[model samples]
Target: MKKIMIFGAASAIAQETAKLFARDGENLFLVDMNIGRLEAVRDDILSRFKTKIEIYEMNALDFDKHQELFDKAIQTLGGLDAVLIAHGTLPDQIKTQEAQEMIIREFNINCVSVISLASIAANYFEKKKEGCIAVISSVAGDRGRQSNYIYGAAKGGVTTFLQGLRNRMTHSGVSVVTIKPGMVDTPMTAHLPKSPLFAKPGVVGKGIYKAMLSGKAVAYLPGYWRLIMFIIKMIPEWIFKKMKL
Candidate 1:
């Protein structure tokens, strides 16, 4: 059976993705900072599927803990076939402007932690010469809009970092996928204004599952956002600066 480790498994998208994988009878190692949320998901998965489900209470931002977490996962599951990076923090943009620490925290949670975790996964996969790493980035990374450019900037770093990792792993039998989800209706986006193109967590999870199976390099969740972001990315900088995105 394929064993998968999901970081930030308490997030809505992670929870939905866990359900999909559980239904397939895959062994899952669900990791999250909130023990309560992790236990709830563990119980839910146990109730629905007759498969192995391990829960890890972890803070993704702590790079020091990553090695220990990876060791424990490998010890419990034998080896990891795939890893899903879904943990992130969406800090208030206004607060970021006032506090450098807030901006740093956002970057650490959204970008640095991903890189740290990916490094561990890369080493593991490289040794085995086989594995998949799927990172959940955001459409916000495509361009820096006025409203949440700080968040967008961090996500942009993640997108670029994953792309580089993909390049590095191309010939090593390790597949790296970057998932750019646009307007996902999760707790993270609850306070944001509604969009016509908004997608549910389940929708994004299904897309990620398919992309992982297909070994897709990069995928935009909801699919249509691929074309939408393509057009947005094409807009000339002069016009882009004049209009609010």
Candidate 2:
């Protein structure tokens, strides 16, 4: 059985991905800030899958403590075959603009914390010369839209960071996958109006699982988001800025 670690494991998307791994008989090391939700997810998985599962309570904002958590996960699993960083926050653009602290919080959670954990994992995986590293970025990173540029900027930084990581790991037998979902229907986006463009957590989770296993460099959930982002990225800035995103 494959040994895996999932950060932000209690999220709807993360839980769904965890289910697939559990069903496949893979051992999992899961963590989330919410202890109750983390335990609930662990219990639910135990109800169906006969696999080894471990849970830890942690807030990702504890950036300095990330290395400790990664080391602990490796110790718990004997060795980590793969790691998925799925934690991030969707910041309110208006609020962030009004409050400088909001922007800092957004970047800390979305970019800083994720990068910190990924850096630690990269070092470990580099030594082994074989492993998978995956992070959940977003299509928002593809372009800076007026609506959510702050959030987009953070994800964009993540995407760029992953690109460099992927490049460095190219010959090390490591796979760094960047997952950019369009509009995902998750608790993080509960206030947003849903439409056909929005994908369900389960759908995105399945895509993430498939991509991670395949070691694909980049994956867009529902697949179509790739084309959608392509067009958005291609538009001229002056012309694009005139239209509402």
User: Backbone collision count in every prediction?
Assistant: 0, 0
Writing each residue's lDDT as its tens digit, candidate 1 over 1-245 gives 79999999999998888888889999999999988999999998899889999998988777899999999999999889999999987877877978989888889999999999998999899889899999999999999988788889989999999988999898899999999998889888898898788899999999898898888999999899899989999999999999866
- Native RMSD of candidate 1 (Å): 1.0
Evaluate residue 215 in candidate 2 and report its C-alpha lDDT on the 0 to 100 scale: 99
- lDDT per residue for candidate 2 within 78-182, as digits (tens), equals 999999999888888888988988889999999999899889999999999999999999999989988999999999999999999999997899999999988
Give the lDDT of residue 232 in candidate 1. Answer: 90
Q: Per-prediction TM-score, please?
A: 0.97, 0.98
Global lDDT of each model? Answer: 0.91, 0.93
Off by over 4 Å in 1: none
Top-TM-score candidate index: 2
Clashing pairs in 2: none
Candidate 2 regions with alpha-carbon error over 4 angstroms: none
